[model samples]
Target: MSFLLRFIAECLFTVYSVSFLLYHRRNFLMKQNHLIFFLISAVINWSFSATWGLAISSHYGAPALLLIVLLELKGLYQMNPMQLLFESGYFVAVLYWGRGIVLPVFALILNQSVHWVRHNRFYYPVAWILSLCMILVYNMLFRHVIAPKAKVETFYRSKEQIRFVAIFQVCLLGYLLFINLGRYYGVDLPWYKISHIISCIICFAAQGLLVNRGIRNSSLLEYELHTELLQQQLERNLRHYKAYQKYAESFRAFKHDYNHMMTSVKSLLSAGEYQKAINLLDTIHETRHKQVPVQHSYSNNNLLDSILQDTANRCEEQSTQFSANVYLPAGHNISDIDIVRMFTNLINNAAEACAKVTSDSERFIAITSRFISHNGWLQIKTANSFHGKVLIRNGIPESTKPNRDFHGLGLSIIDETATKLGGIMVIDVDQKEMVFKTTLLLPVNIQQWNKKDRLPVRGG
Candidate 1:
């Protein structure tokens, strides 16, 4: 009976731990077949604990189990190895603390409660109610209250924060193990057990408070950084808008003077002063070309057109040739902010790559978009010339900038935005031609596009 109870308990704990871990990592695992691997790992973990007993299994069998879980996570998520290790270690710490401390304390409480109640018939029902209440509280606090404040991605990415939590859990586990050892040695000190359990509870509460505070601080820092970036983008947009306004004003002035210039040219021609007429015609042509530069209309979406024009202007300033043929129509499901983010990152990366080419003629950036009417998919492609080798890790090109942690987030931001919009991004590099290209495909409403939405392609 004891063996059966132990085996059942181990199985339940394994399933619970795996479920908790999977729930915490749902964002990363949603698109993958992670359930089967986790289920298999849980079964193996239960088998190990049932066969070898909790004592040997936790100490000796844990490393093997950790290795298996890490391998499964790596194969599925393609996360950094160091991050994987930290995640796996954190899981082990949580599992160890739950099994070693919380479960034992609950069992002790229940055992003591049965003696006080005298009527054993009500025990199972009471236990069931208590279990349900605990689960409800746990979910309400962790899922609803805490999760929004401390997003899983943000929490996991901060190595130091996770490391601190893991260490605290380990310390609590050690303290509980020591208490358990005293009980094993025939120490009949129930008060001592209760006191230690109380201490552990307080410690756990303190740890939770610390973690919450840390997460809040991290969130505040991220918000501030994001706000700064938005301010910078707003300033750039204002500059672009002002430049466009000036260009429009100059074009209007040219239009107002057109009739007078034409009349003057006709008069000069009628008088038969052939050389003077030719000079006057040449002067008018120069004035028209200088004042009314060709205005580009790359897309039906005003915001997208502005972004393209801004990028074009930046590229021109850097002596990099820029070309674009975009046709994004209005009234699409994609938000304007998301479109801005995706296109801005894409063009900026292309321009940066173009800047690396030594030969002026070879430096070029090209962007185009096509709507596949049949599939309701919009494909955007950017191609540019680059001079050096591009190192790609886990499908993302590593940033060549000195401050890699801060500078390399553009691609990730674009990729994340694409993913949020039910899209996929692909990158290709041609070593022979020294060209790098990025392609993004996003789902859009077919009704949003029409023949009038088409725009002529232009190159500089």
Candidate 2:
């Protein structure tokens, strides 16, 4: 009962891992890269496990079996069903004095690779002969079964040893399947080459299925990493946007009050309250001075804030006055994952560029974003100060710094996100002011936004 439970546990673990792999990289099964990965795992599992089962009954006996079950559950790649069963059967046969059987899967691989794998003169024959000799020696010397493990080996042996070992393996496969035929399809054929061939074909299919699965697993891992990056970027972008929005609103209020104050001053001048108006104007200047120390924060999302703060802090440590504004859309139109990719890469790029300068004041950046006319379209702009010439082309900075082989790619990321959203990207540079600006249209499909570039640019 314990054994049955263990077996189920291992099988389920392996299935779970494969399932997770399939989910993460749902498209990987369609690619050929996974095929190579599975083959590599198969080769490793087959050679080691089979050798263990032969030498020590305990290798697959109790504790090791439990571990294997756990490992299978954990989804670590290992031996397939056919390899495990056939190898255990072979060990039993070798221990109890029966005809030498071998792993026919290895035989097929050898037959295919013997001529091509560098004409290994001491190869195929030597391998099987050595395998048989080791078992026979264990039987003769110790008078019991002993499994053999080679540091490196594959079943595709060369033309050096006796050819009969290959035949023995093929026959063994046939015999094993013939005995178990009742468990599968109801074909009542006797155990022979034909039966073995059918099983081998099934083995091939299994291998293919596994390879596709592995590829999918790899792909899933890759995408999961991407989703994480995207999530971080989005938070950063949103934070930068919200800060700008607050600043815009506050400044608008301040300006409205100033206009009223200006009207009062004009009336005071007409009524000959000139000294009062002068005193009022002086108070206004002081008030505006207090407000003029304008502060704009970058990001508010902690997940995103960490990235921006770390980079901005690094820039400040290098003496750059780095400031950014983030604004999240009113509703959850964009997935959080995609947003992460945009801001993480963008903010990192901005900090790196600012950090390159030597002069303290030369290093500076300002990031701002807003929705166009309360519409769904988001407009992002990042401006940074630099000392040297700004050679920007088509919204990408062509670096003037020598010795580096690569040019701009960060903007490329923003451009890519924008493109995916069906929007355009723009960049501007003022060499005289030592400023670089990047503008991107956030992909928000607002009902108020016209697709025909006919929206008004409001100051608010």
RMSD of every candidate to native, in Å, equals: 5.4, 19.3
Best by TM-score: 1
Per-residue lDDT tens digits for candidate 2, residues 98-153, read: 11223232334555321222223333233333444544444333212111111001
TM-score of each: 0.77, 0.33
Residue lDDT tens for model 1, 304-339: 777777777888888888888887754357787787
Q: For model 1, give the 10-residue run with minimal summed lDDT.
A: 113-122
Which parts of model 1 are misplaced by more than 4 Å? 17-25, 29-40, 56-65, 102-145, 148-150, 154-218, 252-257, 272-276, 356-362, 387-391, 400-405, 429-434, 456-459
lDDT score, candidate 1: 0.64
- lDDT for 199 (candidate 1): 60
Q: Highest lDDT among the candidates is held by which one?
A: 1
